[model samples]
Target: MEMIVHNPTEGIYAATDDFVHAIEVRSPSRFLFIAGTMGLDSDGVPGTTLEEQLELIWANLRVILAEAGMSVDNIVRLTSYLRDPSYAEANAKARVAALGGRRVPTTAIVAQTLASGWLVEIEVVAAG
Candidate 1:
């Protein structure tokens, strides 16, 4: 009764089902884009370690998703931009932890991010 596209390229998902709920539902609640999630905590403090950064980022994203009335189960894709490529392996490990070590979302990797001294950045796309 529904179609799911796991991280389709071209910035769009072509599903025909009526969206029941979405992160940003306009006409239909199909694809939703979560903003770039960084290490910044809800209290506005940045994490100093990669592990801490990953935790903060995912936590912040969970809050954002909740505000949109969506959950991590709706996340279909993930784009990860890391400050240092050297930390890629560590980041991946952290990601596994964030995802509860299961249901790894469709993921892409980038070597650099926009902020200065930032270790990692993650953005999510969800379907509803």
Candidate 2:
């Protein structure tokens, strides 16, 4: 299966680096809709900072993907929920690092709160 990323010329360009407006997955693909994942470890301890939480969330996503026989390259979309707007940059940084610069269509929402003490939550859609 192959994923095609599209950024139409007529649409407003994405403000962030390494991001696309949309992604298309070709036929013969299997899709996975992962539940919103937080930054909690196996012991249920959350990360202390925005960056730390973002990193942990990304790691958790990777584990979920791997369990489905998919890797970050198979991800077509990502949605991030942050407790504070200040965490946006850290979110982007962790995403880029986790995907190794591959640009996946993404949406980031600054929310009033997320699960108890979680600083960030991320959900992903992958095709394989």
Measured by TM-score, the strongest candidate is 2
* Candidates in order: C-alpha RMSD to true structure: 7.8, 1.6
Task: Identify the runs in model 2 with alpha carbons over 4 angstroms from their true place.
Answer: 114-116
For model 1, how does the per-residue alpha-carbon lDDT over 1-128 read when each residue is reduced to its tens digit? 14433434456764322221223323445667987788987777788888888888888888988888887776656778877777767777766666665443445466656566578888988767
Q: Report, for all candidates in order, the number of backbone clashes.
A: 0, 0
lDDT of the structure predicted as candidate 2: 0.84
lDDT of 2 by residue, 48-90 (tens): 8777677788888888999999888888899988888888888
- Please, what is the whole-model Cα lDDT of each candidate in the order they appear? 0.68, 0.84
- Residue 59, candidate 2: Cα error in Å is 1.5
TM-score of 1: 0.69
